[model samples]
Target: MNKLQIKYIRQMLGLSQQELGHLIGVHNSLISKIETGTANLQPKTEQAIITLFSEKGISDNDATVINALLEKRKAV
Candidate 1:
């Protein structure tokens, strides 16, 4: 996935960099690097996040799905 997708997913899940890193078994600085477009996620880590998001009922649509989920979370 792209950096924007990663950023959007993390935000949609309302996770801080440290929280997201913990979820994906990475470092907080790595999450910051990815969000800032200075680094990339390995395929395995990407798969882990995709699994997590899917588990949370976030569909594999477009960025629109991410935005919708974020809004849905805020409503709750």
Candidate 2:
């Protein structure tokens, strides 16, 4: 997923960057960097976000869109 999507999802889940990072086993700065476009997410990290949101009962449409976006980025 892209930076905005990441931030949006976190917000939707009522999580701060630090909290999301902690849940995903990363430092908060990493989350910040990702959000600011200073860094890119690894595939594993993206998958972790997806899995976490899925567990939190995010809509299937949102998940599908995220996966599609990730795939499009991979193709670029």
Q: What is the lDDT of candidate 2?
A: 0.84
Query: What's the TM-score of each model vs. the native?
Result: 0.73, 0.77
On residues 1-76, what C-alpha lDDT tens digit does candidate 2 reach at each position?
6787788778878999999999989999999999999998899998888788888887669866866776787799
Model 2 stretches with alpha carbons more than 4 Å out: 63-76
In model 2, which residue pairs have backbone atoms overlapping below 3 Å?
none
| Alpha-carbon lDDT, every model | 0.78, 0.84
Largest TM-score belongs to which candidate? 2
Candidate 1: worst 10 consecutive residues by lDDT?
62-71
Task: Give the poorly placed runs of model 1, Cα more than 4 Å off.
Answer: 62-76
Please, what's the RMSD in Å of model 1? 5.8
Give the lDDT of residue 52 in candidate 1.
76
Please give the TM-score that candidate 2 achieves against the real structure.
0.77
Error of 1 at 22 (Å): 0.5
Report per-prediction Cα RMSD to one decimal.
5.8, 5.0
User: What C-alpha lDDT, on a 0 to 100 scale, does residue 10 get in candidate 2?
Assistant: 87
